[model samples]
Target: ADMPGISKDRLNVKVEGDTLTIEGDAEIPMPEGMEPLYADVRATHYQRSFTLSSEMDTEKVEASLKHGVLTLHIPKREEHKPRKIEVQVD
Candidate 1:
């Protein structure tokens, strides 16, 4: 979810079964007449994945990108959420 300086056009997300995958690539263009001898920034490509649990509601999962930051939301299903069981004594 910490996808800073990444654009939506360069981002790819996929979920299969219980696995979630995220991939992206970024390349900054340089001027033809200007070149830096010492540069710490360069083109980058990344891939990450995580195994989701059965409690996650994959159908309702959502994602949003803002200010180069990506956020993913995976809420627990109603049936999977913790609930207080009622006590009845006969």
Candidate 2:
């Protein structure tokens, strides 16, 4: 789940030593006229971490943000990808 007003600039994604971290912050604007009686929101900061193995190609990663949504693409290495293996029988 993600907040409505989060942008790409506020997000930080990085991968290091088999660890992937995704973090960001959201700003909440104070409503005009009337103040909130109680405010308890996770909109201030967000963080997520993932453990990656050797199969993940960390060097070649892609990320895109559209309409306040973040998308990340992590592709597998050529050796890790699915391929055909031939067997010889004599």
Q: Write the per-residue lDDT of candidate 2 for residues 1-90, one digit (tens) a residue.
A: 354456777888899989988888886678688787787674578888999879989999788877767788999988999998899999
Model 2 sits at a Cα RMSD from the real structure of: 2.8
In model 1, the Cα lDDT at residue 78 comes to: 94
Ten residues in a row with the worst lDDT in model 1?
Answer: 37-46
Error of 1 at 87 (Å): 5.6
* Candidates' C-alpha lDDT: 0.83, 0.80
CA RMSD of each candidate after superposition = 2.2, 2.8
Model 1 — TM-score against the truth? 0.79
lDDT of 1 by residue, 1-90 (tens): 666557998999888999999988866568999877875545477789999999998888788889867789999989999999999999
Error of 2 at 84 (Å): 2.1
Q: What is the lDDT of residue 22 in candidate 1?
A: 91
